[model samples]
Target: MNTPELGWFKSSYSSAQGDDCVEVAVTEQSVHVRDSKDVTRRPFTMDLNGWAQFVTSLGSN
Candidate 1:
C-alpha cells in the first residue's frame, strides 16, 4: 500500500547530535520513518499500535 504523505519530524533526542538520523511522522493509520539524508527513498512504516509498542520497548534499552 502507498503511504500517505506526512510532514516527518526528527527525533528531539537526536537534535543535538545533528542530522545523521531518521525522521518520523505518525498518523492515525501508521508511523512513517525515513533516513534524513535520503528523503526520496521508500520509508518504513508500521501500524500505530505496533509503532507504540516498538517505542515503548526502546525505552528499556
Candidate 2:
C-alpha cells in the first residue's frame, strides 16, 4: 500500500510518551493499521466490515 498517501492518525488510547502507539488509516474499502513507533513495518489491512466487527468486539471486553 502507498502508506505515505494515507492520512494516518494515532489511536486516541496511545500514550503521550509514544509507547504502544498504534496508527490507523481508513479508506473506502479497507482499514490500514500499523505501529506508530515503527513506520517502516508493513501495515495490516482488513475489509471495512471486518474492521467494524473487530472494533465492536473490543468494546465488549
Candidate 3:
C-alpha cells in the first residue's frame, strides 16, 4: 500500500513514553495497522468487517 498518503494515527490510549506504540489507518475498504516505532516494517491489513470483529472480540475478553 502507498502508506505515505494515508492518514496514520496513534491510539489515544498510547503513552507519552512511546512504548508499545501502534498506528492505524482506516480506508473505506480496509484498516491498516503498524508499529509506530517502526514505519519501515510492513503493516497488517484487514477488511472493515474483520476489523470490527476483532474489536468486538477484544471487548468480550
User: Using Cα atoms with residue i matched to residue i, what is each candidate's TM-score against the true structure?
Assistant: 0.76, 0.82, 0.86
Q: Which residue segments of model 3 deviate by more than 4 Å?
A: 17-19
- Model 2: pairs clashing at backbone N, Cα or C within 3 Å: none
Question: How well does candidate 3 score on lDDT at residue 25?
Answer: 94
Residue 29 of model 1, lDDT score = 92
C-alpha lDDT of candidate 1 relative to the true structure:
0.81
Taking the candidates one at a time, how many backbone clashes does each contain? 0, 0, 0
Ordered from best to worst lDDT, the candidate numbers read 3, 2, 1
Location of the lowest summed lDDT over 10 successive residues in candidate 1: 1-10
| TM-score for candidate 2, residues paired by index | 0.82
Which candidate leads in lDDT? 3
Model 1 segments more than 4 A misplaced: 1-4, 15-18
Of candidate 3, the 10-residue stretch with the lowest lDDT total is 1-10
lDDT of each: 0.81, 0.88, 0.89
